[model samples]
Target chain A: MTYIIKGDGSKEKYDEKKLAKSLKRAGADKHTIEQIKALVRKKIYNGMTTKELFGLAFREFRKLQPIVAPKYDLKGALYRFGRSGFPFEALIERILVFQGFECRRNVTSHGKAVTHEIDVKAKKGSQVLMVECKHKSKEHLTIHIQTPLYVYARFLDVKKEFTKPMLATNTKFSGHSTRYAKSVGLRLLGWSYPKDDSLQSNIEKYKAYPITMLRGITPDLLERCIKKEVLLLSDIHGKSPEQLATLLGIAFQKAKKIAEQCKVCELK
Target chain B: MTYIIKGDGSKEKYDEKKLAKSLKRAGADKHTIEQIKALVRKKIYNGMTTKELFGLAFREFRKLQPIVAPKYDLKGALYRFGRSGFPFEALIERILVFQGFECRRNVTSHGKAVTHEIDVKAKKGSQVLMVECKHKSKEHLTIHIQTPLYVYARFLDVKKEFTKPMLATNTKFSGHSTRYAKSVGLRLLGWSYPKDDSLQSNIEKYKAYPITMLRGITPDLLERCIKKEVLLLSDIHGKSPEQLATLLGIAFQKAKKIAEQCKVCELK
Candidate 1:
């Protein structure tokens, strides 16, 4: 055991079990988790900050599994989806697919009063849902009550079509906003909202890591992928590097590296 | 009549009747109109721009009828309401009063799903109204369809408390926005909408000029007046210079000048 300072300035003893739990949450296999733990343990010193400790483990994890390493910094990786919210909406559509929902992105629905360009219209079984994706680039920001207010009002305008409304964000939700949304029965999903079920949890469970997580993916390249509807790692899974290069209009070597990263993120 | 360049870069013969008609629209008296006409006619020369002719007319009109001169540039004066929309909301409240409606400014009303801070809520007889005031500082910008969609959604949320909803703007509304608002039975008020009963016509008919139309009012001073709920030119009408100075925290001489200007805008 080693004493370490946390991100919030609190000092505590670092245990290997805690490190393994986080890796497990990122969907690392037991063997890879042990390898990362041993690699991190060698770099530990008294009073080392958790950040420095995380950096050590993250580097070695990346070398071992490039695909899963991005998942280790999942929150940071998601932030790379950029500010437009289109790619983030694309990610949400894929996650909904894992939940057995058929989705149409950017649907223009005529409401009771005016027409609205909905982010996503999802249909699961016999129920249809209105999904509003709110993306923020910064960390520690909270979705306020006004968002849910307007979102629920929008859903009400198209009530004849959508049976339920869901608000998904890259950040957290304020307590008041959460309470208000709950009272109105509007589903709320954020980084760690709803305890066991959240945007992060759903992404992990569905293995819907975005293509932006790949090492060679630049923002411009990621945007191109989003435009081509190749948002998820699985979307390019099992493709030959030559095929990826032709499909995405990239060089073969770059496509080869991205394809290798996508392999590990493939759902069994 | 000398040929003069118009604002649109086209040349036309200077028509005294056209100049007088505009002054009449600004509520200038017949005597003041004749004085400005004579003043502009003397300054006109062949190839002189209509802008130069109007400048001569406006300067003389200001000397003759200080209060009504601001109305000659009514659209430009309204643009000084600033970007905050608070003073504009205050103006709307006063205008509603002129139409026999008892109005409340910035009322927070609870809705079925969320609470909304309404700009102005008016009640006349058994009917209640929800008012949204949209103020733009730029010229020629139109309120698009999205505004009415959200405004009507907000109204629908609070429909039980209000019988109808009205949208008032300093600029014009796009044709699609107007059609959407009208189809949904929502009232649309702009610089010119709904034919004769537009915002400009109402302001002229009811003499509800904003305090910003007054000369010597700085942006900072106007903000102070808005905070004090002194929005209309009539709000300071009939007040002594000393009273105006104390109410607005300004110089005695400035207040005296403002008070003199306010006298002409007093409602009959």
Candidate 2:
């Protein structure tokens, strides 16, 4: 057992098996994983932040396979999500699933006055949440405050069993919107709204890393992988190089490269 | 001299020349116009309302031409706007032109955070208005209250020359939306919003009827006409039947029928 400092300054005993599992989930190869495991065992000491540990592993991982370095860079990889034409609703649904909620996507329900096309309807016991995803191509756009009001109106219109309406956007939100959300009791999750519960925070909590965040994966290849329904890093992490090549219709070498780097990419 | 009662119960002497000019504007035939005039003269009385006069003329207009009746039915014809893939912004611009406002269409402007695509910008001296048209296919959809808020945010982002923003929609707006619009000072012109200043009122006030509202025109034919930029009812009102047939590449009878009907359809 190794004591490692976390981002929040809390220290926890790190298990090698957990590290290896996450690395495998990240798509690291057997040889790379063994190398990273040996390195972690040798260098890891008390008071070393997980950030430092991640940097150490990332450096070694990059040296072994530079093509997959970005796949391991969580924050940078999340930003790269803006470039892909992936289904955002699926990402949100997966996060809801990770949160132990049942989700029905693209539901059409009749309102009192007008029918609504809900993007996702999540349910658990008597509590229900309707989530709206506003995906924009550009990073500069922000969700205005009225979105909460608009979303809330729709929620009231068709509140059959839902507890409340929550809006999720890939971009940030305005100050007005955050205040409006609080006032109207509309749950909002954006790039940066409701600082405690944002889209970024949800992704972090769920660990739903986008496959496009990987360095070796070009948008064209990512699109092909998405076509094959391999949307996230974990979706393709467990697959063998040969299987990946066959499924993604790429070369064995490229697939192996992707698979190997992804497996040991996580230092923690 | 025959006196006619008006909508407000005021009396005015009916002028035959004024009647003939309005008939021509409504796309009526000369023979039909003459017949209607004769009927109006035969039926005129001091207590006869202008509504009664209009009804008498409409009955005669319908008898002379059944196909063109809907085109003259302003409200019903406006509803037909949903059928054709007509460029609505252009129609709105034409209305603005009649309102004596100079316009520029689809102008792009850079804001502090992001660039915005302005739909239509109308300018008159020191006063300028940025207009956004929200065209929906379904009649049931209402512009939510947040739209005013959303639009106002965009307006604030890029307020180059336009001092005010106006949102126009083909459908109705939510009660909350109307209240919000009033609160925020965002001018809204929907099917029945800003009751004194609505899209319906604008259409009536400007006499800017869409070319697609013509009865002799099919959606396919209207598409072709729109492609040729013949968007308003008055665009081809001056063209001869043969010229219209030649220009539109349709049969002589069809063009003649359209030309004949459009000439007097404006007799209000």
Candidate 3:
């Protein structure tokens, strides 16, 4: 079995089966799978990291399926959010708003007894949900029972004055946690939980992908745009590339490249 | 089969097995159980409610065991706490202190982003826990799954700015709920969960029994004492009958009767 280097410089077996599964999940056809497998075989080596392999695969995957490629790759890119010294929680606020939920991030509410500091509070119709976002860079780490318990416990203190409690993680939840949370009625939205209502599904459904997901934009530049209320890539459409470059202090060419990527985010 | 009315005015078949179990749990010997059973049988009528039956059994049960009787009966008296307009969360704050925890209730902390209204934030050594206390007037009602979910969701919002979250209920937790809470690692202190360390057990352990649990004190009189910083029956010990009546505006005879009950609360 050939091994691939990880972000932490550790080695692990490169499982073809895992790749095939991810590809299938992205709606790649049999012909495309076979073509991608050939490209992987041609490119991978003993010391190559999984990040390099993802870049190679993503390039080939994009050729086979353009629309699905970015969504699939964006899912991978999201895992990097943990590293950016950014208020990704704010980005999440924008996405929830796009999904038609009235959302506020980093808010303080004066309840009858104490003031509550909320990360993200979203309300849709009569339903209000308070979300705890756990962002992990590594996919292998699972959110165990501790998170739900802590969240539930906090919510209990202020439940009479606040919204419903939920746990959202970049990675998946442990089986035991999911079972426990469901039994307690704690809502969970992980990478793949709630099936069609996972984080990826919510982002895809709204087509309101965060500006940080774009290739050329750094977290600092993105924050400036966010401060100016330009949250989604689609929000960049009305601006000229020259103005975008000047406003964000990026090169004209880089700004144009980011604008090009935002074009694909336009929904019906 | 005989039927009895519940608090909701609903009728159900009287189950002697349940009564036997409760009697057994309260440390009743076999002879005492038989005596209580005989009395329950003699008092049977067409329209008697469960509350009436409890009174009949309690009077006899106390004769058999005085110390255990107060503790057991204290569990029953707690259900009436919800009816009093007094802030019982303050009582919970005192209980935590007796358990070797530093507790503050109805506290507001100004965090970096928002002000937090904390019901009870308790600290033991380096560990700090935020508690949500659910006060109930009926023993039949259990803290269900929706509670933890709401608690957890609210925690998700403010966890970043607060301490660890926990849930405490005046009554028992449902079987599914206990199992779920354990799985998720949420520290729970319902009337009878974590058996040895349950909310009821904690009250018993610390001798932090509520003043309302005194045999003759009414909720009205108790609320008045609570207003005067007299929370526990033990707190009643230092006051003379005359002073107690003067402080709370009750009759001298009623104050003497309350003083009589306070004698049993002398901690070991």
Candidate 4:
């Protein structure tokens, strides 16, 4: 009967299994997962907010395994995107580019009935993609069915120009929306949507962690990095901290800390 | 050169030719048009608002030919629709039903990608129409190109349920929107758009004036009538003033005036 307050001020029964499942999905080893669960159980109290509970778990995971901690909090990093959703769109474009797709962001093209401001357009040899990025900053909200509905509509308008339609998101998709998308051959990539290839898997496979996940940087700094098109950890993989400090106009120590965190996340 | 302040607070040089053309379109006789033109010329002053000029013209038109005056001020009456755009949608549904189409208002149907709340869905034998009502309360705003784009996208989603997509509005369509709609085989219906089959022609041909055009009732009463599904003057064509008063909970004199106005508008 343990109840926890959710981010939206609603109360829900605290479920230990859900936290364990999320930790597992974050690639935490079983031993570390057990230790985190023990710590969370000891700290669990009535009327605690879910944010506090997750923060505790994330801290413990970071302490136990620094390398995998970034991945564990990847969803949180994605949530740091601003309300405009532009940074999320840019991140999707960069991720696609890392995967060998020639990608363009914020592209405008005429559809059959009207012009569309496509978030990301990618092409690889014979494959062309019209990717719509639906970014929600809140954790509980899923990509609804209406998105793919309108997205498919936009694709139908510009199908002559693009070979396929894809919807990318930072969160998961509703069951009905996923089924509808699957039925129409509309590809979906989200936190945990499609079985094998998802937003998480794509980022993990290429180690293209969003710059927001780096330690010792504020949201404002992350925004400037996004504006400078430095979204991925790989974007600063080889650069020295001094170079990053000059590029981002930040303190040398803050840049060094971010650089160190990026190296840790990029570890094999 | 007389400058008239438009509804949007932009100033424009007054054109007598445009006034005459609008009067002619409202079914005014040449002699009456000449008299209204003379009156407008006499009243024209620098820095006069377009609303004031139109009020003078509408008043003169009412005195000369009261029957056609409602049609002349039809655009203004349409602009009285609330920001929610529901009443305008109801008006379009009534107009379609008058034209022998089996019409349904606010119909929800599942498209391939999602469910859409269509403003008006009309059916005639094998011909099915999915109509989107883009009602604008502002007089200066036109139906832009983006509307038909999304409407067509929704149509493509539900094309299995509907034969064609049609965009209807109380205002005019921008030239680019009209051309884009035409090129994509999307039907366009708006004020003075599509020549013979425009919304104005349809209303005049069938005399299906909106209840908002009735002189006696206020906007609150018009909203109440819309809530009671009384959008068209034809809806109250045969009802006596006493019965209308009983149904609408309004004063008998107000109901009588509305009945009298409907009679005048419905005159062949």
| Top of the candidates by TM-score | 4
- How well is each residue in A175-250 modelled by candidate 3, as lDDT tens digits? 7567657755778887777898987777777776656567645667766776676666667866788988877777
For candidate 2 chain A, the 10 contiguous residues with the lowest summed lDDT are A77-86
Cα lDDT tens digits, model 4, A183-245, are 788899997768789888888887878877776458788778877888777788778989989
The lDDT per prediction is 0.82, 0.72, 0.72, 0.83
In model 1, where do residues sit more than 4 Å from their true spots? A1-24, A27-66, A82-85, A137-162, A172-189, B1-24, B28-66, B137-146, B156-160, B263-268
Could you tell me which residue pairs clash in candidate 4?
none
List the lowest-lDDT window of 10 residues for candidate 4 chain A.
Answer: A259-268
Instruction: Give candidate 2's whole-model lDDT.
Output: 0.72
lDDT of 1 at A210: 73
Q: Which candidate is the best by DockQ?
A: 4
Candidate 1 vs candidate 3, lDDT winner: 1
Interface DockQ per candidate: 0.20, 0.06, 0.03, 0.27
TM-scores for chain B, in order?
0.83, 0.71, 0.79, 0.88
Ranking by TM-score: 4, 1, 2, 3
| Residue-wise C-alpha lDDT for candidate 2, range B145-242, written one tens digit per residue | 55765677667656665788888777788876676566556788777566787776677566566776676457788777877888776788879999
Candidate 3 residue-wise lDDT at A88:
59
Q: Name the better of 2 and 4 by DockQ.
A: 4
Candidate 1 has an interface RMSD (Å) of 3.6
Error of 1 at B87 (Å): 2.3
Query: Which whole-number lDDT from 0 to 100 does residue A85 have in model 3?
Result: 32
Off by over 4 Å in 2: A1-167, A170-268, B1-68, B71-76, B79-86
